[model samples]
Target: MSHGSSPSHLRGLAEVAAASVLWGTGGLAVQLIREHEAMSPVTISAWRMAIAAVVLLVALLAVRRAGELVELARSRPRQLLVVGAGTAAYQGFYFVSVTQVGVAVSTVVSLGLAPVLLTVAEAVRDRRPPAAGRLVVLVAALAGLLMVSVAGHASSTGPAPVAGVLLAIASGTTYALTTAAGGSISKESSPLVLTSGMTLVGAVVLLPCTALVDGPHVTTDAAALAWLAYLGVLTMALAYVLLYSGLRVVAPSTAVTASLVEPVTAAVVAAVVLGESLGPVAVVGILLVLGAVAGLGRPAAAAGPVLPDPDPVRPPTAP
Candidate 1:
């Protein structure tokens, strides 16, 4: 089979898409958790990372891979730190931006910008402009993202739009850089190990911030705890494992673009599960985003350097 049509490549695309869908569920989980507890976003995020790290570490130990995680930390400390800190920084900036500007602006500016940044970075790294087709996909996905995000929260403007936009930019930049760095690292490390270590690092980074922002309150409410567990295990832990595994075969730019599915999935979930109505424009935006991701799945567009699997005998597993 041709490179683009290889099982691994197609599997990678599916893995990334699946991860985005899982991420989409996080919004609902967060909303549910908030309904049951008065926790701030930062505190929730800290809990999410902490829970995911513990779960991942426990899995590693169960699989007799604890030593591998330690080796990863020992050998690639800087890269691991960068990935972990970047993950925490982007989410922190995004949450703060939401409070400062509003969800519509923060979501569009932060989530929408990462794909564009990664595409441009890829072009620069390759010393050639992005293919015309890739550019079209990027534009379509971004337009869809803007429409979906803005339509949902048209009147939800925050107190400081300027600061929010700046924070969103910081979030986007960090997200793009982190994706790039993670993709590179995945070429040499197990996705599970990498995710475990980075999540631990991210939890450590976010704990103090959560303490300062919301006093790090953990809800004893059963429903809230369940939702928090969903956010940590499904969204953070499994989703990231899939993301890193997908990064092994998919280009960083394409992977980020594929993740645009998250907002679309979120919109759909909100509409169906919460009985929130979606306007015609939002429906169209969902179509556009889905179309763009489908376009990216084309062999020509999806083609990328397929790195050697870290463990040929045991392929990266995704939940």
Candidate 2:
């Protein structure tokens, strides 16, 4: 069978989609945590990475996989540094952008821009333009994302719109670079090991920034602690594990496009959990995003096969 249609590729797509859904829940978790104890977004993000790194480390030690991490650190320190620092930078820029430009502008610009940039990068690397159908799908997804974001925050402009937009662009560019770097690294390392190492690096990179920006506030409330734990374990650790694993077999462009599921999942979660109503335009936007994702799922005949899974015989370890 063609690689694109192989079971491994489909599974990779599913993994990426699952990761995006988990990421969607992160905002809700943050909101709940803040309800119990006020905390700045940077502090919360720092805690999320730190906690996830710790949890992943404990799991690795328990499973006797710590040696793998050690080996990865010794062998691929540069890739780890790029991915880890890029991860923290993207999130930090995003939060600051949200404060300056508002959630809607930040969300639309940052998230929407990544896939486009990645797609263009892919095309440039391959010395060809994207397929017409793929371009159509990308446009639909971006338009849907814009609609959903604007509908959610129509009047939510921030203090400095231009600065926020620039920061958002930086955030998206950082995300694209990180994903591309991570995709390359995943081909040579176990996703679990990569996630643990990079997240630890990310925590280190973000901690001091968090302290400087938000004073590293710690939450003592039980409810907030639990929510923070959820953010760390599920959203940060597990979701990233899935992402890196999927990147091993999925094209970076396709993977980023699939991850547009994040906003759609967020919209649905808000409606059901937060009693937030999705207006008509937002609902249509959701459909468009879902449709675009579905369209992108089809095997691309023109694009070359994805990288073969390095350990296709080995089953995925539990995150």
Candidate 3:
């Protein structure tokens, strides 16, 4: 409040922006290895959370937290459990949905609709409404999502597979909660503490599901394993840290819009890794999504964060 925003705050915002871009690639990576491995979503998710957790735990011990793991461990076990259980459910549903549909479909549905969903979630919890900028961002993002839906439909058009579409929508709904709930956890705690505890919870819940449903045999392929590791280490574990740290300075809508990077990265990766074809229309759709996200980032007054209404039946959460 003194001489504009501090340099440190500005720097932190940038870091969060960068983290979001990296996160945007997650779906594409999932698509690449989805069929390559026979493991269930639970297995993939378990490995991801487990590997990321280990890396994060070590990082916190050696550098960030500096030997505070035990202290954190003792302090917030229940909250950790709650976060992990929520994460497990979220990932399991995500895996099933992505498997049922396609990567693009799932991501567009979940993320596009996330703003509106999260707005309501926050409103209910805080008993207050969203800011105008946040609402605008939601509308613009939803419009972009609608474009994505049309593109997906045009790609197929054989009755459109209603179930998969529905699943994709459900994925988006979970994402809304994922973000709102996830972000709320660390206001009074360290990001590493929050991430580690929540992820541990996820692993505990998912490990069993992986065992019961996915069974003993897991993917042995080194490439699949490597990708899963990357998801855990870079996307889930490290990414969250960067994103959270950045959010301390960056506005939430701006941070999320910057995350459009994940999809762009994922799309390019999908093209190269899975050999999945894309047409001009898909490219245009990607451009539109990126453009919209970019537009939302101008400035608070220029075209900042777009939010949503407080009412429960505000609108359909997907495009």
Candidate 4:
């Protein structure tokens, strides 16, 4: 890694961490929405994506960036669409995992698996093994993620843990692909443009599934609407913009590792808001996860972007 890229790498890590923190609050919001409105996971995801896309589009038009969206659509339509599909798959699988195994395990399985998958994929593509120190940090981060998540699993009796785990694995795979692809896509377009184009694609893919799963279920309650707005604006819109911006310079493995902060934030929120216990183990796990993230984001860990540049309209064909 070149020293010239160090600042960019650190910036990327910070952006990703900020996004993760926002995402940490998402589970609670989703739960609130479910309580207020009887909607399936798919339906909630649909609403989240669709509303977010609309919000981004409106903001773009308001700021005179609609032309950027149009240009990106024309220039990189296929890659953006692929990224959108991956985003939809990630959310769909994650929410389903949440319904089946509870939020803790779902979050653990999905987020935990992403860095490892990215590490392996990168190694394979680069034909070089990860550095010893980086590998150690990665393992430590994964362990801490598992510890925190398991400790947070106070309500393990949700549905089917096994099925949820599988779904969460799928979610992780999709998430990894999305993040890696985002890195490549960022090279071709700005984060705002990418977010606008990709979210539209995700909304298109998820709308039909939402309709089939929830069957015209709609709610206009103030609380439900509030939760939906939060999900759309914060979780979907802001978070994704941060994610893509980070990917512009962050290695996929480092980005994913830093994002383990999500579970830590989620745990603390659960303790304070949901009145769940953090326990000594969970607290220790939080420290470990944070430490690993810090290590991964340090100047020493700086590396070039994990993927090569290519046509934005191409299939997101490689890492």
Taking all chains together, the TM-score of candidate 1 against the true structure is: 0.94
- State the lDDT of candidate 4 residue by residue for 49-158, as single tens digits: 88999999998989987877777777767778889999999988988888788877887789988998988887788898877767878888888898898887865756
Q: Tell how far residue 151 is off in model 4, in angstroms.
A: 0.4
lDDT of 1 at 201: 98
Residue by residue across 92-163, what tens digits does model 1's lDDT show? 999999999998899899888888888777677779887667778888999999899988888999899999
User: Candidate 4: where are CA atoms >4 Å away?
Assistant: 2-5, 158-162, 214-216, 302-319
Q: What's the TM-score of every candidate structure?
A: 0.94, 0.94, 0.74, 0.90
Indicate whether candidate 3 or candidate 4 has the larger lDDT.
4
Model 3: lowest-lDDT 10 consecutive positions = 310-319
Q: State the displacement of the C-alpha of residue 212, model 4, in Å, after optimal TM-score superposition.
A: 2.5
TM-score of 2: 0.94
RMSD of each: 3.3, 3.3, 7.8, 3.6
lDDT of each: 0.86, 0.86, 0.59, 0.81
- In the range 1-319, model 3's lDDT, one tens digit per residue, is 1323345445555565567666656666555567577665567778788887788777777776643445545665555565667667755665566656665566666666655555565556667675565566556556555555445444432234466667667766655555555544444456776677667667677676765774434677788877888889888898777765555444444555555555655555667766766566657766765665654443442122222212322221211
Residue 309 C-alpha lDDT in model 1: 44
